[model samples]
Target: MNNNNALLIIDMQQEDGFVLEHFDSTVNNIAALLDTARQQRVPVIYTRHINQADGSDMPRGEPRAADGGPSSYRAGTRQVEILERLAPRADELIVDKGRYSAFHRTDLDARLKALRVETLIVSGVLTDVCVLSSVLDAFALGYHVRLVSDACTTTTLAGHYSSLLIMANWVYALEILTCAQCLHALCDRAYVSLAPQQPDQFAHQPHELENTIARLHSHLVRTQE
Candidate 1:
């Protein structure tokens, strides 16, 4: 536990382009995490996936609006704004990114370096996309990454868990915990995180998705002492 920890919320903008699994619950969990972070005086950083209003920064082969604008997270639109409930304060850092990874073509790394943030507590939408990309990049950039499982989601549960498994399998010292556990960890309380205990902790075939998810959930829950 240290003061070098920061919370990284990724792609939780108001874009309604896709329906996420457990979105409401995810938002609630993120809210809780935000509350704890602020109370703990931990730095909070938010990312907005804003594309060029004229579609100039749209990813290659991305779907386009009939009017030729970026389909989602259009710059200058409300959709590109962070959720009002979880909006950052004036002193917080807000990073606007045109790509999935917050570190991609953005000053996120530089800012984190300036803040001397060594660990990142990650949560947000599109778990398999932006969140996943951001977590991987964070790891590559030499920051300790912790994920709040319930605070992140994708269009489907399968995508969400699969991404978690992928990261757990390869992120090296990744720590995957639930929202409650994350809150406890922030407070320097006893909390459990499913860190890499062994190689391929979640290794499985595609058909083992359900079983793997069960195993993952097992790590996220607190058992009777």
Candidate 2:
């Protein structure tokens, strides 16, 4: 795994009205990715969407209930907390925002730069909303993005699939893969853990080892170039 890669888990919170399809499977896949990231010593970043207690930070002209009550994700409320199953470690970065994109009015870009994160492994809820927004912004900022298909879901299957297709085809050259594929790619790059026992056998063709490493790294990052 590249040392400059980071895992971004966006808005996996406990909001009441935000029901995702295949919630259990998505969470499990996210958890697996989280474990792999930690094992590879990659930075893990989490994003939470929270608004003001009085709904002052909510988007203006948003639709309201028949009673004219505003719908908001209040800060410090249980609804805004990250889901317990994929809780971030104390050492991980947790960025709170009031907008759909994690970079909007937030320090996510700076934080990722500080960690020297050249690639972002993205997974989270609402594939067509926050995930799509964040991925677009990340691409704009020149970060190679990998979207874990099984680790993300939306309220509707159509939304999820449509968003993935748009991202893969038009918005960006995103490397979309399953949790197992991602894990295997990460493990393959960890040379210390997966090194061959017979080092002397391949010493005559050192270029072969170099080429293998380069190919695997390229496969993982999937740069547009």
Q: Highest lDDT: which candidate?
A: 1
What lDDT would candidate 1 get against the real structure? 0.88
Query: Residue-wise lDDT of candidate 1 within 1-225, one digit each (tens)?
Result: 245899999888888889888899999999999999999999999999888878887878987899888887889999989999898899988998888899999999998888889889999978899999999999999999988899999998889988999999999858998898899889988977888877787899878889998888776775212
Expressed as tens digits, the lDDT of each residue in 95-123 for candidate 2 is 99988998999999999988888889899
Overall lDDT per candidate, in order of appearance: 0.88, 0.77
TM-score of candidate 1 on Cα atoms, chains taken together: 0.95
Query: Which residue pairs overlap in candidate 2's backbone?
Result: none
Candidate 1 residue spans exceeding 4 A from truth: 223-225
